[model samples]
Every structure is written in C-alpha cells, then in structure tokens.
Target: MTIKPHALKKGDQIALVSPASRPHSAEALARAEAVVEKMGFKPIIAKHALSINGYLAGTDEERAQDIMDAFSSDSISGIFCLEGGFGSIKTLSHLDFSQIKKHPKIIMGSHENTCLLTAISNQASMVVFHGPNICSVDRVESIAEIKSTLASSTILPPVTPSLGSFPAGFHHTSYPGNAQGTLIGGNLNAIASLMGTKYSAHFNNKIIFFCERDERNDIIERWFTSFYLAGHLKRIAGIAFGEFPDCGPKDSLSMKSYQDILTERMIEHKIPSTFNMPIGDSSLSRVMPIGIKAKLDATNGKLEFTESALD
Candidate 1:
C-alpha cells in the first residue's frame, strides 16, 4: 500500500539532516535555517548534519542514523537533506525501511538523494518530495509555491507555460499519447546507479521522470541504453524527461544532440514520452512527488497528479 505522510503545518518542525554531502560552510547552513524560519516552519538541525568525512557529511552509519532519528522523533514533522553531492547510497543498507514505513514523514531532496528517494519509494511505499534542498532554500527566487506544496495534501497539475521558465526543449513531445501511473524516478546518474540492487525502482507500469546534469551526451546515451537493456523502458507506462543542463556532447564531432539521443531511444521502444520537464538541477524547478499517481498527457504536454501526495 502507498503510505502518505501527514500534511505539514505552519509550525511543523523539520529536521535538517545531511544524508549526502555536507553544507558548503557554516554560513550556508545558517542561511538555510533562516529561510526555513521565514517560511514559517521550525528548523531542527540533525545531530551530525555538519560532520564532514571527505565529501560526505559524515560516516555512512552516522548519516543513516540521522534519518532514522528524524523519522522516529516526535518533534520532527519532516526530514530535509542539507544538500546532495554523493554518499547517500552508502547509508542505504544501514537504514531501517521498516521504521520509516511505520512512521512516514516528508523526506525531500534531489540530485544524489535520488537513491534515498527511490529506496523509500520502493521499500517504504511512502510519498516523498523531489525538489530543492537546504542549499537551494535561499537561492530560489520564490518559494511560496514550494511552501504551498509542502503544507497541503493536494494534487499537482502539469507544467504550464507560466509555471516555469525552461529552455527550448520544454515544448518538445516525443509521442502523442496519454498514460497514467504512479510517478517514479529522479537524477539519471543516481537512478542508473541503483541498477542490480534491491533499491532499484520498479518502472513497470509507472510514469518515470528522470533528469541529469554535467554529463556528456555519450554518457547519457549509455545510461539510457542501460535502462533499455534492463527492460525498464519497455514496461513503463510513459516517460518524462527533465532538464539536462550543462549536458552537451564532449566531442564536437558528435552529430546528435542530447535530445536526439533520448528521443531515438524512446521511439525505439515506442514509449509515450515528453521532454523538457522543469524538474532537475535548476533553480526554476518545482516540487514533484514521487510514488503518487499522475497522468502523463504527452499529446497535450501535461503531467497531472491524480492524488495528493500527503494525507
């Protein structure tokens, strides 16, 4: 069964945990805290949120423990990852999925936290947020919509022209068809890393939305081919491509663009897909709920949620 967390309130206390990388500095954390407070929610820093172990926030066990503690805590209404770099996968085995399943709460982040989000979706069957991290809290221009999404249990509609500012690809559609399924997916690199693991997403009969950044077209092609070889692309109800900023071909001699590579793959499998979705490593991204049922209307360029992500 799908487990939805309770809707957040103005006074809800959110725990700031670093499941992936540590904050850039103490100043960044303070700014993040200030932004959360300005949003009218209490920010509770996780015990080891700032511990740095090379690039990671802390030891794998310590990072995992923060998540466990947050979910098990009576005071914390939600858990927000401080930032996403790498290391979340190391904590996967240490996490108690059962404990999180028993006490579902909003767990939100993007990029490297894609592993955690997918794991929670598959193991806990809980609706989780895929959006800005604590690092992006202060940088985003307007967070009113973000606050609204977190504070209520409401179905979200597809991206409209006015909803976001995307590049030219946002208007592109691969196939003219409509399909509905529970939303599943996140960063392309992170999602691909989950292959051959227990935490890998079950894309069968689901609307998969994926994004990437700082990768070359060749690497993107390889990852897409991996999904196809794994039989994930053949079984999905539909596909939605998100922003792939700074992902151009490393070799100038390569003729195909990143969009061409993605489109050819989807067409090869005849999957109903849309490109240029606003969710990804961009400041203009909006919150997208994983594990929630949504309709992918490729014919009309829309992805409308059929249910609320929270109770």
Candidate 2:
C-alpha cells in the first residue's frame, strides 16, 4: 500500500520551499534556482521561503502551509527544501497527512528535514527523497542523480563501494553479509530524535537502515547504545552509515579511531552492516529514495536498488 508519486517531466513546475531555515544567503538560493532550471524544470519560491524568525525559516505554521500548498497544487510536480538546520519537527503537527496522501508529489531534502520525509513515508505511505539540499547541490552529477530519479523508466544506478570515496571508519565490511529490504533512514540524529515520537521511522519488517551524522564518537556510542537497548539492532536487515559531516567540528575526523566498539556490536549481533558509504553529505552521495526496496551487499560493500520509488 505504498503511495508512489508520479514521475516528473521536463518543464514541470516545482517549488523551492524553506521548511527548516532560510538559505545561507540569497546568492546560494539563486545558484540553487539555476541548478533546478538546468534540470529542465521551472522553479518558484514558496510564499514564506525567505522569512526568518530567529533560527527557523519562519513560524512552524508558515513552513507547514508552504508544504501543504505544494502538495495541494496541481501545477507543481515537486518540491526541494531550501536547507536543513532545525525546526522541521515543529511543522509536523500542522500537516494533514490524510490530505497529502491523496495528492502525492515528489519532495526532496536532507539533514534535519529527515523528519518530514519520515513522516510523509510513514503517515502518508508515500516515497520521499533523501538528497542534497537546494543550497548545497552544486555539481552536475548530483543534479543528474536527482533529476533522473524523478523521471520515469530508469533503474537508478547501484552504489559500488570500490567506486566511492571512503572516509575514516567507513568501510564495506564492518560485518560480512548481504540482505535485501526497504531503504529506511537519513541523518542519524534526526532519526534518533523521532524515536519516542509519533513519527518514528519503522525498524521492523526487515529494513536496510542507512544514516549519516557529524557528532563525536562518544555521542555516537551513546545514541548507538540507546538504539541497541530499544531492540532496533535486532530488527534491522542490514545497516550502512555515511561518514563525513557537511558542517561539523574538526574533531569528527578523529572519530575514525574509535570505531571498534560499534564494529564489535555489529559482529556480536550478526547483522549485515557496512560503514562509511557515500551517503548523506558525502561528495559521492547518490539519490537514495526513502521507501524503495534495495539490496545491501554488505559482504562486498555495495548497494543495489531492486525497486523504484515512483509509480
């Protein structure tokens, strides 16, 4: 009963919505508009996409309304979040998932926006995109990946570890095995924050959970231990974590040396897992759909999509 959105077409009108925070700068937003245009789509800024209220882009209600407007619009075929900082969770209460389930459209973002993606997938039963935010996407490959995914009749490319730029502690075989399941996760901290809430992402029914974060190793362990105690580790079909943080302190680079503790837990649980895949803010990140079925070839350190996220 998954709700897949219609494939996007060239010249399809789309919106650039700021659900979390305002763009880093007006220049960055303009560049983002150019990138979307280069993909052959006409982009419009949402009504409140530029309003800023302290750290938030605007009030929670404003952000939620823009998203609702995008979903309810007939002309707009997709949405791209301006950037991820904080405040997406606040908008959840304002959204009407039942209304959204009837008018599914492609919505893409990453970082703190993961909560929105998770909620849409869980409540609306719709597929969502975890990808580079509007202000951060500056490359031809990244553009191609997102554009190609929303279009019809193409199997997204597989992520072969050998072809990716691996970061510290992020290798293909933290635990040797393979498993196939729905791709379900985004920023590790965002996912963790939703754990006790109504929007928590599913961990049961076999899932290839993927995550990325920019926190220190000790914090990672605390969160990882919490997940383990909650029985999440026992339910995952496989797991992959992206290493580098897009905006983190310098100490994150030293996190590589403290990997053994989590690695041991992976081995002990016997779950198929891989570390440091080029996901999240990594330069080599691919457009990973939130609810699609994929094969995690952990033994060989590869990820292959087995099902499309679009109808």
Error of 1 at 258 (Å): 1.6
Off by over 4 Å in 1: 139-142, 161-170, 251-253
Candidate 2 runs further than 4 Å off = 162-170, 246-258
Which tens-of-lDDT digit does each residue in 145-262 have in candidate 1?
A: 5677888877765653235463433457887688889899899989999999999999889998888888888888888889989988889999888878888977655578888988
State each model's CA lDDT, in order. Answer: 0.85, 0.81
lDDT of 2 by residue, 1-311 (tens): 78889889999998999889889888878898999999999998999888889998889999999999999999989999988899898899999999999899999999889989999989999989888887888778888878887785455777664354634324657888888888888877778878888898888745555555556766666667877899988888888766546423346554443357578778988988786677785456776788888888888777888877787
lDDT comparing candidate 2 with the true structure: 0.81
**Structural similarity to truth (TM-score) of each candidate:** 0.95, 0.92
Best by lDDT: 1
Decoy 2 TM-score against native: 0.92
User: Candidate 1: which pairs clash?
Assistant: none
Q: What lDDT is reached at residue 201 by model 1?
A: 90
